[model samples]
Target: MPFVKTTWRNSISFKVLLAYVAGVGLSILLIALGAFALITSRSDILLTTDVAERTHELAGKLLFDAAGRPTGFDDSEGDRVWTFKSLGEEIGYRVLDSQANVALASTDQAFWSPVAKAAPSEQGHFKFEREGIPMYAATAPVEHNGATWYLQFAVSERLMELLHQGFAWPFMGAGIVLFSLVLLFVFGACAYFTLGYALKPLREVSESAATISPRSLHSRLESKNVPWEVAPLVRSFNSALERLEQGYRVQQEFLATAAHELKTPLALIRAQIELMAPDKGRDSLLDDVAHMTRQVQQLLLLAETSEAHNYSFAVVDVGEVAQQAAAYLQRMADAACVGIVVAGPADTQTPWQADRSALFTLLKNLLENAIQHAPAGTQVRVEFTTSRLTVRDWGPGVGQAQLPQIFTRFWRGAHRRDHGAGLGLTICQEIARAHGWTLVAQREEPGLSFCLSRHHAGPG
Candidate 1:
């Protein structure tokens, strides 16, 4: 129960729904209260109206003599007579002349005399007590043969008691309660669906935010069709993304520029070292210069591959690229006493849409890294298909804890022995990302397998 309360408090949709229901309930309650107050305050007026109507109806049925003198009511209509008779001793009426003398009365006249005497002479509602029992009375004007008379009607409290005994008030109260419950349900459902629709743009913005990374810093949340209340937040988020994109662009430009600047000095240093006379240190200096040159070149390539527009994409044969990469690294593999084997489809005719040069670089880097890691006299396997490429090396693979950092920039696992900079896997990952693909490194039984494939939508 506390969990439910906490969730309801924390959830914006639930809070909105609760507030809406409360507002609707309050409005309905106010309306019911107002209606009850009106009915209660005007109850006497309603009873007086009832008495006046009954007096008029009885006046209409009066039978007079030829001299236009007051007489009794005509009972020719059996239904009307039966309705009046059903009231028993609860209803009584009296007709008075201009002299204020009783000209005629109902059969139960004695039961109403005290009430009539206590009533006011005015033609409206009046309250009185008769033998300790409360009574309601009304006086109305009567006209016959151009002479004016008055009629007084009285009803006993027993009539209202009969209505209560019949369960009239209970039925009415139950009906009101049922109506309020149904209205609350309907309003709650409407609030739920309306909130879901109204908040749809927020969900879209969240999804778009989740997909944004350093590689996709230029992407922005869509603002169209967003609610007015949330538009400012969306605009602010897009503005932040724009700033991040500018900063990332500047950082990449700096890296590329630094690499470009170092290339010439390194070339000069290599030339001078080669021009030196043969000595024990001369070859070592040249080797160090060569390694620095290679590191600079890899930095330039990393910066270039990080951007999407740097690659010129086209349809190329994947099998052909794999073979070329293998052949290019064959000398290095032989120097390390590691064999290179390329195996795939029978025809080796796999076609894919990618940048030919970038594709070659990606495959070359993977195979080079595999060759460097493979044990002496062991073969590094290269597999290619229409949708995926796999490079497997039978060497000491990194631990499971190090798998996530394999593709991280400058992250050389414990098993690697290469003197080169650790940008090979990071470059491969960048190239795969540029092509809308994923590069994953899996720990094999006795080695590591790097799989490059298109990003599939569902689980593997």
Candidate 2:
């Protein structure tokens, strides 16, 4: 299937397994061929060498008289006599003098005489036929009592057939096949386990990378125990993180600097507007200046909250913080003709560890956002516990599609009543992130609810 092929192409483990299997198969095939060739070449050589050795051995066993004329063999109780008896008619030999005359021959002399005559003069192997049966022969020189003689030994072709077709070929083939299978299995298992062990560090690197964000860009992958082949990639990735961290820090610094620079001029403009005579244009100018000043201050707070190191952490009560935020936004709720209610666990003792100032800012922003959206005479409820906080307003909640964009920087929903900059929810989300928490928006049947909960283990 196409899926299988794609996996084979893309997966490292599949590729490695395939390569290992192929390499092992090729090696096994080559070894089997080489071994077969060696056996084939050695079989012929062994036959000839065996014939020559038997010729010499028979010559040594020949018995002679005092005049040095050849007689019958000693026929002693030894290996040569036993070999002659065991082979019976399959083996034949002849001993000839310096004049090339036969001195002694096996009982079957008629068949062996032609073979001896056809043998080479010097020591070597030759072939002949006896009654249409093919045979192999070898001639060798012999010395006895300072007289030189030649011995020719012949064996039937059936002997070679027995060695090749009868036993060696079949056993060698089965052994090669069995050995190749066992080797493939054992080596394949070893390769699979080794590849898994080697790739463990990569999995660890992935987990570490998942934890990295603008806030925790300082983290890097650990290199210890990693394979040498992958070490360079890990180093390169760490170097990339270093560069990214530097760029993010520079951007945060620019945002903070720009917001700080705008604050002083806005203050001076406000002081100047206050000096002007009471008029409709003067009030409009002051309102515009105040909105700009609020936007600048929110930008500064966003920059600070985005960095993990900016917040000082300590134990703080969630319920108390909720009450404080409600009280702080009471005037704004009153101006909008909306009631503010705080409800949570009765315990006042601090139970959560967080940056007190950042937590206050986060609560304040959520409550302020709720107050701005709630309908007249409707209540904006603030609820909290040791682990969570929620702010709900009885007003026209945003559509489902707009829920995800509520915490995005400078993003305002369709439900709005003022010309204020949309950085409040974004600042709240950043503060929650710095404290290893999650802030989310859900649509209550008749309102929108914002929940900030201690959910994650660490900053992004």
Candidate 3:
């Protein structure tokens, strides 16, 4: 039951499927952009090349006078219209008397924009716009007998739109076809066989695990047949299961021993109380009762710490928690002459994903432990933020050698007084682990600093 409710609610296969979809979607988006751009560019280039070839052919047909100087255009069939034409290409226009105010434009003139703006050196590719449409234009500048002749042509926005739409659907259709085929034939087949191979060891392991009871949890999944990618995870799971089963055995033994041990002493105390006169042993009886109560509380806390059942994760406001815990401990601190101050800003909201009650207990225990070890009249401070909670006490700082074992259960440091159940810091650390945070005891030179930090999700 303890292991059944553990945290892997979102399975690995679902995450992998989501990753695959996202990866493919991103790849599709990029390919779409590239394919669109390439198709449009090729269309424009093809049209421009056709116009250039025609212009060059026209320019080659030169008419010469008797003096061997260029005289006029070769108007062979008296068709001046054909001379200025872009040779009926899809994306070309011509400039007429460009040095003058007069410029003749084709019906789809927006394509001239890019070809028009191009420098004269570039076989004259430039950009020009006409009538609210954009265009790509290419011009060939030639001089005939002291007169300048210019020919320009453009590809229109309508044509560019048409070109993109024409090619885009086909490209996407092809992508869909290719993607489906690959996933069905290659990836599906590979995954089917690979999954069989991958799950073989897991199936065997599960069979072995299913056959096991609490009596035989020491048996483990075989490591030799496990896939390399999954072996480490299986090994860790096996190790944890082994540890849990051992702890179960240890706890069972402890409970049995403790019950027998406690019953005899309690029975003796009860017999003594029944025999005593009210005035004779009332004070001693009260003291023994109090001692028994403290022992029972300590034992219960130690058990809970081992089980880690005292902790549960949720959003906890640490600043508010500090105030609450400080209030809880104020009476004891006051009796001990310790100045306990919850010094952080009250307006601060530090919502921590943790066990609220366990956090309260952790802080309360640390503060109580500090008050026990602290010099009298010392100040104890508790501060909190979104990612960290810190407690400080002007106690003689912890020693160098004893630092490592400070959070080990039942560890009493050198400055130890009659602090109840040296499991306070151990509980704090255990609670931190349950919430995936860090609980660290740090030396503050003349004092001690305990920090519970939310490990940030990055390399900050």
Candidate 4:
């Protein structure tokens, strides 16, 4: 039922096509009805004519002596003299005297009897329904030797019904089929272009909306070119974009000011903590300050990467960048009793065009994440190829359910022990996205691997 409802709501072409077919079908139905009425009406006339003609022939065959009356049946005469073409099933006819008494009946069934209905005038006819069977009859008065007698002829309802059905259905079937094809072609073509013309502005609006990213929020939708019905919607959307751009500008300013205001006080606190005693409590205070400082630095880096126009691309080697990031994080790895191993093609320069600072930060965040999570004495392996850099650590791998959330801001795993804020993977993801690359996280057998690679667009 949901599938049916969705198709019905979304399919304008099918609705239009069905409407066309229905209109044509109704016209054909009306035409068929009129034709049936005409044929049925004409069959009555034909029945009356046939019975009247048969009565006239029967009148000629009437024989009488000095007294005028119907002659007795002759055994030598064949059935032709009595048989009727107008009578179908249960065929029969009656010969009646002037007093309306049945003198002779052609079949074994009881003969038709006159009722209170008006009798047929000379050469005229009347219809009667007896026992639910329509009987058509015509009367012709015959005079023999100065006395009078009458001949009556009749047929049943089944005859006329058969004739009508035979003539009506074939033509109706043919007419419906031909009109269906014609409507499908003519109306289908018209509806296709008509819908396209009507939806043209909506398609343009969609294309324009797709291009308006965070950097392009200043762009507004053009309402003058759209239909009047959709102009209000476009205006409302442009107004919303205006609000968003304003909020984005304010938020960026606040982040920049906060970074400046918070960093100085944090640096003073770290300095003050270092001048204190070498006890566990003092060490804990210093660690807390360092953790806070790292969070602020990551927040600042995230803010910078949000603005894409600030980037400057340079040609750099993936292997060289990986080696430098490992060296920079070596002391941190050693402090945790973990090893750092950088592996790639020997003497192979896998060159790529990227913002060198962004790539370095991307590598730094991933390396830090791998080293922090790695078990003691287990190496964090950094591998580089022409297109991608992968960092694998031999620690408890992320759960399958949590892999998708790893790159989200401030999302930390249950197995993690660091007091570090969870912006590391988020920063790496932002950098990768800024450079049109893809960052992926995979859960290994006994560890997790984070990889960054060049993203390729699909074929047009």
Candidate No. with top TM-score: 1
**Tens-place lDDT digits, model 3, residues 309-364:** 44566777888888888899889888888998776656768777767777787888
Candidate order (TM-score): 1, 2, 4, 3
TM-score of each: 0.81, 0.80, 0.45, 0.64
Task: Indicate the worst ten consecutive residues by lDDT in candidate 3.
Answer: 100-109
lDDT of each: 0.81, 0.81, 0.67, 0.76
Clashing pairs in 1: none
The segments of candidate 4 whose C-alpha lies over 4 angstroms from its true place after superposition are 1-9, 34-180, 200-204, 207-227, 274-281, 415-417, 457-460
Candidate 4 lDDT by residue in tens digits, 61-131: 66554455566434443466544433434355556665656666665444454334333334258777767
Task: Give residue 362's lDDT in candidate 4 (0 to 100).
Answer: 88
Residue-wise C-alpha lDDT for candidate 2, range 1-460, written one tens digit per residue: 1433455578788899998889988988898888778666756666677666766666677777898877757757254655555775667777778777888776466776455444346546787787777777877777778997777778877776677657877898888888888878987898998888888888788798888878789888898877888889989999999999899999999999999999999999999999999999999999899899999999998999888878888878877777788888788888999999988776566367889889889888888888888889999898777778789998999998888888888998666677668999999988887888888999999999988788547532
Candidate 2's displacement at residue 267, Å, is 0.2
* Regions of model 3 farther than 4 Å from truth: 1-246, 249-292, 308-310, 416-419, 456-460
Clashes of each: 0, 0, 25, 0
Candidate 4: residue 445 Cα off by (Å): 1.1
- Kindly list the per-residue Cα lDDT of model 1 for residues 283-380, writing each as its tens digit: 99988998898899999999999987787877799899889998898889999999988988996588888899998999999898888788899989
